[model samples]
Target: MKLIAKSMLVMGMVMSLTACKKESKLNPIPTSLISDASAYDSPDRIATLVNGLYATFKGSGFFGTQYIYYSEARSGDFISTNLNPTRGGLTYQMTVDPGISDVSAVWTQGYQIINACNVFISSMEEKGIKVLTPQIANNYLAEARFLRGLSYYYLLQLYAEPFTKNNGQGKGLPLRLTPNKGLAEYNLARSSVAEVYKQIITDLDYAEANLPANYSSAALNTTRAHVNTVISAKTNVYLSMGDYANVIKEADKIVPATAPFVAPTGVKNALQTEVTAIFKAPYTTTESVFSMPFSNTDVPGTSLANAYLPDGANATGLGSAGTGDFYLFEGGIVSDPLWKTTDKRRALVFTTIAGGNKGRQWSTKYATGSPYTDYVPVIRYAEVLLNLAEALANVNGVDSRSLALLNAVRQRADQTTTLTASSQPELISKIIHERHIEFLGEGIRNADLMRLKLSVPAKTPLGSSPVPQINPENPNYLWPIPNTESLYNKDI
Candidate 1:
């Protein structure tokens, strides 16, 4: 996990905001600063602070890299050839111990981003900013709040029980809403899951009302917290909360059914065609709703492809399976009849001996650049469609609408073989299947198991199955809160 080492004082004292990689090349996080009075003296300085928020997102701890690695390793999507994913090796399968470096990094880095967001949010509220930069400050405040709420949303999923489990009354991360003014604020206690969700919803609600609806720049629209990002984030939060109604409500903004799906800001948020093309390389499509940007000069320490591909000396891919660390369970979607023939998705996986791993199957999604520059997709338009489909299936059972949505995704990879299911349960099953294939190796698998209350099927990294069953209720399923917070925060 990566953390920007900027304090609130650093935020205000900044003279220039480093331009992001969206428009041009991305440079490393800039550490330039002056003093608060001079910083906020101009509206441009405050704008730079807002850019700093995305800078945090670019950190390796957040979307820059490890977060995706942690999520996928824990999830069933990819089994590791190495025993310990935390160490340079692969996962030991959700280590019972909380001291896993990667896990700890995730916690520490997550909080770092949270703290950064808090500082931005609280700093924007200063009365001086109201007089000098009300509009810019409000815009940035909403953006910061949206990003902060999204961070908490991710943390709650990994650290707390699913909201559906106990109506969200269970243990949640400690609420650190205000800026960390001093060491005294570090002692805060954990908030209830419902409380966290409420705060998340509150922040996002404001973001929806205030954040710019559209940006002409794809970099700003997809990489920054615009209306689409907020909508995507809200969909994820509600889905995790088991609030199907709201999931549909948020997803509806991006699903484009018969009409062109657009963000609440009136920006076109629909998926781009050519499923393989969308992910084969970086910045491939408009389908990417929200993603973290990385450039050659400022690449995250480890690219997402590191463990998945045994090539790219710059990649941290640990791929060592002759067949695949994750294999088709057999007689199912992985072995779909079309896979042997026309399925374009199947082509992305190929066998090769590289990086000391022989006959390992690797996904080409991250093979774009020598060092693997594929951007991390935090939210995709396809996920929105699937979320909406799942919500509708659960709400109205199997219907034409849900079927159409599910089929649309299914047909994306291979239009020749459109799929269908007989009931709501069947349709939901299809949606899950589609996600596994659609998001393979992207880090969505394990979390899906936890939220859907599904079991993790043990398997060799070679894609062989029938290892064992990890019940969804296992405590290991929920990552432990890092000692960084628990040990320091007495309330935790």
Candidate 2:
């Protein structure tokens, strides 16, 4: 696949590759250029390139904010209160076009990360062993592959058809593996969805074998990819592909067979005692398998906080402040009676009364004020458990282990209410509903809807206009391939 260096420059990779640095465990900025000519000259330079991949992944255009907002808003979980087009109004209304900035920005940033990973992987394979030990070199290569695989998975969720549809015999993104440097690489065609999933699994398999079992600190364990991280990601990928057997197989690597289901070997990840604690100060809990960490110095601009939190006057004692661009939809999962008011997860939603309206709820999940420093969760242990539960129920109908896994997540938040299902379909229904409640404001809804080939649910109009339900057959069901790609990559 070919992309012009000019396109890479426009994606901000030229600057991010050389200068972007976030302070944390992955510290120590480098002053060298991250070019093919000199990027692998020293050990620190190689490490800086790795960190740069993460920086680009966590940028606002991707995971930093827009991705999460796009996923949830499009699922009808959140209604646009402000209807600000720049802030995801088009996404909420299912009106995104190829030229839309959000669509283009996400695609551009995704490819930027993928290309950086390819460059880093190639450089490491060719020259990294010269500076670093073989063991360390392979570990770094695995990390690059892990990021590359994850980027492709995320892009497919929005831009391509679901793998469950006709066994992934649908158009997918360009499977760009080699480093795209010039115009010569600009005419690559899209691959099949099954082909993309094959590549994603290949990358993740290598990562599970070569990536470290655990890191030194809790922060590194939570923020960086480890053995269990790769396993957790594979479970998600397999589940999306309707490969339930593989989901169970991959999940079994980390999740135990009994209660207190902590990963026994690498990164003792388990559900937090309290659901909200995972989102609090120093958000590096074991439950957080992988997340995009942020700090006051390096924040997710105009992303989480600004998109979710209500204004100060409206928030009152919600203990947060922001522009309050979106509110929990009255017709969303929040309205489900099964999601009890006393449920601990309900604490994340707060009620605000205004303009004679009785109870308008706003999310306090990303509660930080101005700079929105909340670490965005990429995958959590709870999700892995649910994935395993759903897969088990599919493979073995109404099984005890599957029910146990389902209740593990449910009873954690709402101890008073235990879920029960008599048959396989019933059990799966409960598990799906549990996901909607458990992952609210965390950006899992739309992906769940898509992977299962479910319709984007109809939303009730509040401050903004009503959005109709979008079935799988609708043209707007999937985000269009960005115009930038269409213009540059003729084969697309």
Candidate 3:
């Protein structure tokens, strides 16, 4: 989602006044403020705010810009190159001090979007608008909360370390619930990770209660919001925190009554399913529970797809330097056969540029021509099933059902070998491994490694040929808070 820049702010003012319904009595604007709750009162007026929230998912300010890339960059997916560039390599990995550009951008951007959501939520009641109703106001408040929770989820992950058994015992990003009035109040201290997670859960619960089951195709493809996606995302947050019990509880709410992990028609395949469709464009599929919708309207074709495209491909007609600049996965060289050829993930997840040459086809999944408009799946039915399997395997042992779920995914990927049985440790490890492969470019690696307490050591094919050991204590594990937040809040 893109941040509402000053340019956008002006547009918002223009849009609200023109589209706002007659019933919306403009609230008295504060002297210093140019806009506020009054900006989103009537159905037409509040619609503009939805685009602002969607903007948070795009651009350089927040997750879409750098934070999302940070997760994949540190992982095996991409190496920095001339065409595909990443600051992390220049700063965090290679040098003594890296600039705070990427990480800080995400931090500041997320909070900015959160404040936007809060503005909408705080005004919903005062505006006497039915923003939560179907069609009337399109359930704006619920969507806002979901977006808010997702922002916090990313913030907590980036600013704070993974939660321990004590549940957020360590400091977390400062909780900012309301829209700021440009006050000079002291920023709150970092809350415990547990407290942050609690807030996230609370926000998601409210979102689920008010959101609808699914969106129509028109809504799905456009900037519009729906209810089911929020619920699916909540399932993801619970899984990340290792709250497997809640994972199962939340997933059950959306999964079809008969099918274990099927999403509704348009959103089906949100579950991990058939091998081929998994790889093709419409990059995100039916299985997606919640997705970050993208549009050419903001990012255009060259933004994301170009970065992941192979070097010198027809797809990249007017190639940008971002294309084929990074290594797709570490196992690009013959010496680093990290993945097996027979493993369907090899094809579905990656491609070789220039006819399968080493390092050439590595970043194939994200090509220049890939419609640039496919909503990136932040959470899908597949993850929910995997979460349930992991939780059940950890707590109840890898029984028949658990093994079935695990194998179901592997089978779809056409893995030659099948696991008969394994202990909890083995099962959990396998589950995570599947997640790593399944979600390679989608940005879930660091969180998986952190939560699992696994070493950040690189594998032979991907990292240093001998593999570099990534100690957890390394500052790279947790991204630095943005300078803006540090300047504003003392929590850093």
Candidate 4:
């Protein structure tokens, strides 16, 4: 059933991509057209659709690859050295134009998943599958809702201005709660960030309330949405919303009283003692909250190795991340830090200059084994701890608990030293620094700056010092609504 469902999901999304075409000569009908009755009336198909939704989430267009890479590159974590600059979002080469392919792919692919969730949710509620128990059905609904909320979160971050930037009134994604139905459904205008966030909170709130504590099946465990999974996502949402108190409230649900802090959902997550092992395969670190895994057989088409590591860079024969475009800094905090040169986090990526390239220090985090398999970590427990510490500092002006959380993450990276912050602002600064170093290649830098309303201090391969900052007031900070969307949606 899993295999068949996985295959169908790939086909399902492929068709969705085809449907996104602006113009075509042929009038090809969809290959599989199961009506609401055919899909939802059966318990088996309903179960399969739930898994299929995950397949959509796992797609390269989403979390499987592009989402992570684009976020990292655009956030100024790495400078693009490639001549053409393929991934425009990473280097700020693309314009705030409606027709840009890179930005359009993100919009189209995100809505594909969003619409898939809408279909599953509507069918389950309207048609009713008799074979499953009530608890099972509710869990499925919770999972669908979580994914919907998650999809919107990513879209908003990329396409809309930061919620905190203009008091949440910026043009946001079209808040489509129902299953898509042809051009009519597609032709809608943007919602305000505040409005979209309200919907996201509503969906996630239900997910947190009804989702199970955990699942026994390894496949069904952390990969699926449980209460803690929902909480982890909600913490992220609140953090993005700049609701620091709510961020603390949501994070507290997962954070532990001490080290080896296992979540209430039975996820035994903590700051990994060894920094390098965090990105390795089978990805069950003491710190992973939610991760999307891919093996050799079922790969995220844009594998991180292929996107970050250059050719001949990996002697492991696994894969490459890009054509040597992704370059890191030797003098920056990423490699040789101004504060702590002995930090294990810096040492991990700089090991062998990230598989030995001539003019660049790259990342080896994704270049795992032969055949190059690794997982995309959607959220980590370490981030939650950092969020908690930052929130505490923001709320109470740097207390013992906040400082301890900061020290815990930093010390976990390098046990020989502990960090100190005399004031709330100092502690918040330390917490942000910890996040940057801790999640170096993991792609949180862009979002961190967005929520803080700070200008992106960008650099280029050709230039020496930083480029003019991409400011908070600029439209380039957010991607434009696609030409496809504007062509169809009159309100756009």
Model 4 stretches astray by more than 4 angstroms:
1-37, 83-85, 89-91, 94-96, 217-219, 258-260, 313-322, 330-332, 351-359, 369-371, 460-467
Candidate 2 residue-wise lDDT at 131: 86
Residue 412 displacement (Å), model 4: 1.3
Query: Which has the higher TM-score value, candidate number 1 or candidate number 3?
Result: 1
For candidate 2, list the clashing residue pairs, or say none.
Answer: 2-185, 2-186
**Which candidate wins on TM-score?**
2
Which is the leading candidate under lDDT? 2
After superposition, the stretches of candidate 1 with alpha carbons farther than 4 Å from their true spots are: 1-37, 85-92, 131-133, 257-265, 280-284, 312-341, 353-359, 461-468
Decreasing lDDT order of the candidates = 2, 4, 1, 3
TM-score of each: 0.84, 0.93, 0.80, 0.88
- Could you give the candidate ranking by TM-score, starting with the highest? 2, 4, 1, 3
**Cα miss at 202, model 2 (Å)?**
0.4
Off by over 4 Å in 3: 1-38, 82-86, 91-99, 128-138, 183-186, 218-227, 256-260, 263-284, 300-302, 313-322, 329-339, 349-361, 370-374, 415-417, 459-467
Native-vs-model 1 lDDT?
Answer: 0.65
Taking every candidate in turn, the Cα RMSD to the unseen true structure, in Å, is 7.0, 6.4, 6.8, 4.0
lDDT minimum window of 10 residues, candidate 3: 25-34
lDDT tens per residue, model 1, 290-403: 877666655666666555654443124433222123322233335455354566777666554356544445565665544556677888888888888888889999777877
Model 4, 122-180: lDDT tens digits are 77787754656777777778888999899999888888888888879988888888866
Instruction: Give the TM-score comparing model 2 with the true structure, all chains together.
Output: 0.93
lDDT of each: 0.65, 0.83, 0.56, 0.70
lDDT of 3: 0.56
